[model samples]
Target: MRLFEDNIHIEIPGRSTPSARSPEAEPSLDGKVNSVSRREAVEAFLRLRLFMPERQKRIVATCMNGEERQYFFDKMVEIAATVEGMPVTYQQDGNGDETIAHLHYFLGDCHWYITEKDREGEVEQAFGYAILHGDLINAEYGYIPITELVDTGVGAELDFHFKPTPMAQIKQALEDRYG
Candidate 1:
């Protein structure tokens, strides 16, 4: 079955039935797909889940069974662990200096500019400036759990085009644009 399309397109094999046709094919980066297991297909779907819109998510959810949903979360945790967190030095420096935000997460007017992360902790926590619904007065640097951003229903998205930028510069830009 054809999942969805974006930068990369994935087509997982459908079940065996007389009515079932061959999976609609989409070449990956390498342009080859000899075979794909159900687990692998689910993994690919979860990896791209963050970037997908709410409508697409609902559609995908309907296609997935309870087992697949559980697998998706388990795989997500594994994937999260592999992601490189903020450096120890950055955490130690605190928010005193003009720290660089290495990651940007956004959904509509809300934005999370991640500066530091506690990699050693059981639950991944990011220290960053958050501006929710353009509330500049309330926006402040604080701990934001990575899990919150990855929640399937939340629809939060990581800005793939964002580059590391100074918090001061970001603040200045926000002020110039919003003020």
Candidate 2:
């Protein structure tokens, strides 16, 4: 097992904790219960209600503390519901794949995710571009804390794919609840 740090991959030989999903569902190519499958990734995102507007949610499941995971998911949903609604243009870099971004209203945090694939078209690595950490502050509405996500490459920028007709209602609900 290994923990990949900021742009650096480190290897460690040891037993890893079990995944949140079932082992029957997350099998590896070599018949090992090792890496998270794409299906598991999507399931994790959906279960957490995380949103990635530009790219499809194809991230691997990662182990994170409850606070960090909540921060990331909370930000993801808020961004999808508010600022960037569906039918929005998907922004891609020169390689023709989309680059995703999201805004967190809690502390006005925004993040940009850039995913790079390998020669076999499998996800090789992912990096965050506009990774901003929000500071805890008092706003006109209420308390706002700086937000942060787990450092693992498990997070994705969920897109707002629903109809715009119901967006206004959703945004109002968020403002009302979070305020």
Candidate 3:
């Protein structure tokens, strides 16, 4: 599959490998040839983690050497430094139908649909709808410190399969499920 717009290409084995190109034609990171820029590679890696099916990830993993995998992970940390978290006002200016929840954190029967985040404060806070212990009646929109969720031990997990969804839809789904 084509990984970048540049001449550098990686063909999934079983498919034909492109004829040898000049060593000077490929981009190099620490003297190793790479088909894409570090940022693009890292972005692709993140997309793979979030969006690719588990089977697909296994297929891709089989294609990468341990060194290549390590390089991508190391670069991911460096690239993620510049990426911004959810802003405090994220989706707040919009109605429920327009506001989107971009993150999902869950522990047992508790679920947090995180629509916004405040990183400017000393303690990071997330704003969203929270349902605790399946209590739909008490579920409401509010802020919670991110540390609280992180400190919830190993039970809490960020749902990697969650897609950004409108708050209205999420609310309706919860109502339908819990009512």
Q: How does each model score on lDDT?
A: 0.60, 0.32, 0.58
TM-score of 1: 0.53
* Residue pairs that clash (backbone atoms under 3 angstroms), model 2: 51-158, 52-157, 52-158, 52-159, 53-157, 53-158, 53-159, 134-146
* Residue pair clashes in candidate 3: none
Tens-digit per-residue lDDT, 128-152, candidate 1? 8899998888899888876666574
Each candidate structure's TM-score, on Cα atoms with residue i matched to residue i, is 0.53, 0.21, 0.54
Name the better of 1 and 2 by lDDT: 1
Candidate 1: deviation at residue 152, Å?
5.7
Question: For every candidate structure, what is the RMSD over all alpha carbons to the true structure, in angstroms?
Answer: 8.7, 15.1, 10.0
Any runs in candidate 2 off by more than 4 Å, and if so which? 1-22, 26-61, 64-86, 90-165
lDDT of 3 by residue, 72-120 (tens): 4444343233223444655475566668786777878998887776654
* Candidate maximizing lDDT: 1
Q: Which run of 10 residues does model 2 get worst, by summed lDDT?
A: 139-148
Off by over 4 Å in 1: 1-85, 89-97, 120-123
